[model samples]
Target: MLSTIATTIPRRALCVRTLPISQTRYASHGTPHYNEPSGYLFGEKPLPQGQKRKREDWELLWYYGMFGSMALAAVGLYYKPDTRYAMAFIPQLLTALIIFNPASKLGH
Candidate 1:
């Protein structure tokens, strides 16, 4: 009786294996679907006519100036112990101010 039951289960499992695939159609040559229009099909907005990009010449000058001053201060500190290492901080502080002022304007 156990042998008969095991033989019947395999036949039932084989009968359940067949199924159907759902069908979908595409345009000629089967191009993929996309939500956004392609760049070639769309026109990009031109930048505003009057507003100018700000120049960074002043900022660059400040950076290089402060760097040179700091290097000089470091050499001075090595040669003269009386000249405090703290003096080197002045140019670094000014450089921080110059760099941050323009950046702070962007937040507004």
Candidate 2:
């Protein structure tokens, strides 16, 4: 009975088959290939146009201006020996020192 049942199934009906895919002649021709080297010398990415420099030129100018004024005040006190000019030098000197300190965050 088992031998008769096995022989009853057809070989082609039990077999699995894959479907064929349709191909176009223009498909391989239109694909782009980029195997050439790009013209960059250093291999570095380009900087954005909107990016600006971190340092401010005006901050250095302000520091130097305060320093120069302080020196002038000290000289004036030496020449005139007046209490008013000497008092003026005090604030100028403090300002100059504060601006020149490395730990100060004025420029940053």
Candidate 3:
């Protein structure tokens, strides 16, 4: 008994082109895109080309004491009238107006 086999693989070399990457490979890599956000739980600071962002004042009094304790816990969860029609206190009144609107912004 005997056997023989032949193989060929050339349907235009199994086409998958998707081309258009010719900006000199990002001008030889000097900072085409690395907008500073390193590994491990997101951390990026990057701001000293003209220096700005420095919000202090005890961090706006700790975000105005976390918007007055989430506006007294959304007024005790809408002071119970069958949980105020099951409104669920609208995410603590939208997180107490987004932590008191940037701590009542003053400068930055």
| Candidate 1 positional error at 11, Å | 99
1 versus 3: better TM-score goes to: 1
Better of 1 and 3 by lDDT: 1
Cα lDDT of model 2 by residue, 1-108, tens digit: 988778766665567574559755665665566435566654545668998646577988999899999999999978984566577577668778774454568767
Candidate 1 weakest lDDT stretch, 10 residues? 38-47
Name the runs in model 1 displaced over 4 angstroms.
1-55, 81-108
Per-residue C-alpha lDDT of model 3 across residues 1-108, encoded as one tens digit per residue: 122222223434557575677644535667646656566354645677988877867988898899999999999888846755547767677667774344455566
CA lDDT, candidate 1, residue 94: 67
Name the top TM-score candidate.
Answer: 2
Best by lDDT: 1
- Comparing candidate 1 with candidate 2, which one achieves the higher lDDT? 1
Candidate 2 vs 3: which has more TM-score: 2
Cα shift from native, residue 27, model 3 (Å): 13
- Candidate 1 vs. true structure, TM-score: 0.24
TM-score to true structure, per model: 0.24, 0.25, 0.22
